[model samples]
Target: MEFGLSEDQVMLQETIRRFVADEASLDTIRAIADQESGAQNVLDEKIAALGLDGLLVPEPEGGSGLGVLDAILVQECFGYGLVPSRFLANTVAAYAFGASGSELAGNIASGAAKFGLVLNDVVSRRDSSGIQVSGTSVTGKSLMAINVRDATHLLFYSDDAIHCGAPDETSVVKTIDRTREFFEVAVAGADPDAKTADVEQVFAVASVLIASDTLGAAQAMLDKAVVYASEREQFGRVIGSFQAVKHLCAEMAAKLEPCRALLWHAAHAIDENDDEAITMAYLAKAHMSDVATFIARTSTEVHGGMGFTDLVGLHYWFKRIGVNRQLFGTPMVLRERAARQQGLVA
Candidate 1:
């Protein structure tokens, strides 16, 4: 069976790659890193123009009605650019709602609203007064939410359902990654009755998209490291000619390139609703998380002192991959999940 991307998919990836290369370069990422509200109107406009905002929405919802594979492609490009936008939250929410056949899914696909997702596992129950969500709010403290300020609605998961609420941004954490922003939102209450029974599917979608993003960043870093090694000369010749530098660059490729196939398999499995989709997605994420972390380190080490400096701008990709690795659980945790699926562990 052919595993490579189709012509259209390849074109789509190329188009977004060009857009990121030209419009959302490292310099642009650096400029927006320090903002309190990381909402970029122009970035959103550009994405909307391409109809990327509607990529995962079903056809009846006024979207392109694409599948997980398409979204994964664009997200990978977003990773390569290291562009700080609300794309992840937007796409994931659309995927969740659309996949579950929710009415709210229609609105999002039509570009009527944007969303932010806080991946906290909240407990919920129905009570005499109404639906209640525990740990949704406590002394105005909540888990860190990505793109909370940019979202019109805040989504939280509880009891296999998704609840929507407005955000109270009293305090937002200064996370390690400057290219992206996160907020610990204080919500009034997440309506437990809002939406139900596919939170696991949504989390699966989120995990693959994130893994694709890290893969992109890792690829970019490897490319930069290889180019630099080939150009930068030492006492006698270019550093890449040396065994150590060549090995570092080669190892990065060996680790990162194979990861693309796993990501592709995971995305395809999800779209096909294959039996192994969940386990495959987890495997892709676990493998990429570890690979990305290693590539980030090796890529930087390849650059020598320049890698650590902001002038080279490699740190943006470095930190971005690091952040992605932490999200959706660590490599070891995800590996354990994957292993248990195959009856490899107790």
Candidate 2:
């Protein structure tokens, strides 16, 4: 099989990239980050107009009827631009609702409806009433939850039931990335309409999108660091020309490539509906988590103290990567899963 983007895929990728570059500037990102709503409604509208919100749903359901491969390409561009939204969560909701043959698909694809997923071990099984129903507190704090502020609905999985509920920001805790905040949501006995796949498929897709976000942010950090190194001289020489700085940049790229390839393999496997996709998704999440953290740290170090300053624009990507690294599945948890599957358990 050819391992290259088809003409349509290339066009779609370009379309996404252009829209992001045009609509999501640094000023816009900062504005949204500081906004109370944290909802980029203007940008969201543009994305919807482009038909991206419906990309993953079946054509009959008013979706693009595209596959995972298409979603990955478009999402990767979203990452490259640091364009913040709840695109991944909506995709998960669409898939879950579609798989369950529910009417939620139309709600999700139109952008009028938003969804968030909970993968943490917060709710217990005994609390569940049925397959699509469960119970929980209204104040359960989840780390690095996405799109909580604007989510109209949430998909939650626990030991007992996979469930859904509405957003309750009053119960949400404060977050670092205000633009992508999550709330302390309760199950409230709502039914989710689907079962959790063995590999945590919906969460897996979220992980991949977060990985793509990290990859793009890392690339941005790397670019910013290189420019800073070249311009900011130390000891009467451009730091970028020094062996140490060169190696640092090189290592950043090296760490990034493995994460990129791992995600590519995982996404490809899922699109093809291969048995190994589950295992590979875990591996990809595990690899990208570590790599993303490393890139964030290295970028900060390369930029010295300036990286931490808001004026430098590096901290935004750094914080996003830091948060993404721990979301859905932590690197440790994913690695354990991958290791066990590989029979490398101790």
Candidate 3:
């Protein structure tokens, strides 16, 4: 009946924020531009040491066996810090593998293996015998292929099944967000007989984490914009004293706060297996995408000219929001899909 994080979840979120602030500071991210993968390894090790890699893995498999709500708490912190990692892909893959009783799930849970997501549409066809699985050329230019260089496997789904294959090689592709790297991958020949797990549950899980990420970044932008407004002065008065600046900050907060409830409730809905979980998750994703985009744009405006420059480093958060907005699906795409699911559209 209550809609709030428990004491333990709050502590978990606090712990992650402290670690990110101390270990993965803005300066740390700035220095990693030239060699992101190397820096990413260092970051991954720290995350793994925290056993975050195992957050969704079962206790028997060396993971926390935590549910969706708990995952949302941790992911939100990752977003606030703008920390880059393939933890989201790994989480979805873990769910698929764990649900299917794959031993590889344990490897992933223990951080023994890493994976990347194929965010593009994929097709799988049974090769005559209804077993030899072969379909699309998954190894190509994907828009949001995170952690591809370091991932031992590239994961995608088709025909209601999860498929994993090693990437032959990957080259870093420049995206607007330098806080993280995306790759144009040359997917190596996948094992046609690779393990496959079919379920819609992983989709919901991924959507919730993404929504939580939006929540974190949007919240950070709002906070930074507020702080900056109060400090900068124009015409002998703090800019925040101006009605326009105050309204901008207020409007951002007003739009962003409600996204938190939508995300939290969606995460809770999935964990509880509530009937509305799918629609709720879709709503969370669609709504937060809009919220995040608004915060990113307005927050930058609040900072004026300095906002667009790397000197301020606000662009990192801003670009991350842009990437998240377009990542899994755009706001319109998600909304239309939700409508179809609710039978409001054909």
Candidate 4:
């Protein structure tokens, strides 16, 4: 079978690329990052205006009704631009609600509600943290909750079930990447009526999307490094003329290029409900984490001292890739999960 993105998918990719270039320039991203609150709302409105919030919702319920592969394409553009929005969290919540046959799926489709996702517990649980669900109520704290400040509801897993409720309070969790918001959310006696979707499947979708984001960010770093190498001079010669620099750029491309195909297959597996979808997602996430880190480090080295400077702004993409590496599951965690799934480990 011929395996590639269809014509429409290519167009969708291009369209989003154009949108990112026009709206999410470094200056705009910097301004948003400087704000103390609602930093993501600026870009979120623009995404909503473009109707991207409906990217994963079913058409019958007023959405584009696209699949995970298409969502991956959009996410790649967002990552490339370092756009700060809740597209990742919202997409996962939509999938969870739709899969569970919940009425809230309509609200997500119409962009009437936004959701913060607490998925860290799905991978590694913390004894001192995590929410607990009781009869129609959820109470406790969830750390590293995505998009909590603006979320109308919180989607989390507890006691082997999916729960959604309003957040009673939120406190920001500072990290190296200020481009996106992470929070410690507190919920008390809130609704716990969300229907359950397949937990593994929801996590698989999240892993794939996060990996796609890293792929885009790494691609951007590689592109920038190549551009810098061509123009930056050293001892009356462009850095690109040096064999060592040439090897570095080549190695980055060699490693990062194949990640696109890896992510494509993983996303396709999820959409098709293939037997290997879960394992593929874990593998893709793990592989991208390793490759993206290498690219980020090598690309910065190519820029010499300037890569670390704010004027060059390479750190933004560098930090974006850094954060993506840890989200959902780190490389170590994901590889262990993949091995267990394949019966290769106890």
lDDT of each residue in 1-346, candidate 1, tens digit only: 6678889899989999999887886666776775524346566677777778778888887878888898899999999988766677778888767766766677777666778777634211123212236644422345556877657776766445666766655357676898777765666665444555666566778889989999989999999999999999999899999999999998899888899999999999989988788789888998899999999999999999999998999999999998888776677777776677678999
Q: Give the clash count for each candidate.
A: 0, 3, 0, 0
Per-residue accuracy of model 2 over 1-346 as CA lDDT, tens digit each? 6566779989988877888888888888887778735348787767667767777777777777777667777777777677876777787677666656566787776666777766554211223221233233433433334566556777766454445666554355566655565655554445434444433566566666767777777778888888999998889999999899999999988878767667777888877778777678777867876887888899899999888888887777877777777676678877776676567896
lDDT of 3 by residue, 1-346 (tens): 6778889989999998899889888877876655644676788778878877667778887777887888888889999988887788888777767655666678888777898876434211223211112554443434446777668887765455667777765667688877777765556655555556533456667777888987888899999999999999999999999999999999999998888888889988887888778778877998898878888999999999988887888988888888787776777877776787688998
RMSD of each: 4.1, 3.8, 4.1, 1.5
What is candidate 2's CA lDDT for residue 345?
A: 92
Ranking by TM-score: 4, 1, 3, 2
After superposition, the stretches of candidate 2 with alpha carbons farther than 4 Å from their true spots are 36-39, 122-144, 168-170, 192-199, 235-237, 342-346
At residue 335, give the lDDT of candidate 2: 73
Better model by lDDT, 1 or 3? 1
Clashing pairs in 1: none
TM-score of each: 0.90, 0.86, 0.89, 0.96
Put down candidate 4 lDDT per residue, 1-346, tens digits, no spaces.
8899999999999999999999899888887778745545667788888887677888777778899999999999999988877788889888887755666777887877888888888777678788887787677787888878768887787777667787788899888887888888887554545757588888899899999999989999999999999999999999999999999999999998899999999999999999989999999999999999999999999999999999989999999898888888899999988898889999
Task: Give the least accurate 10-residue stretch of model 1, judged by summed lDDT.
Answer: 122-131
Candidate 4, position 8, lDDT: 98
Which should have the higher TM-score, number 1 or number 2? 1
Best by TM-score: 4
lDDT of 2: 0.70
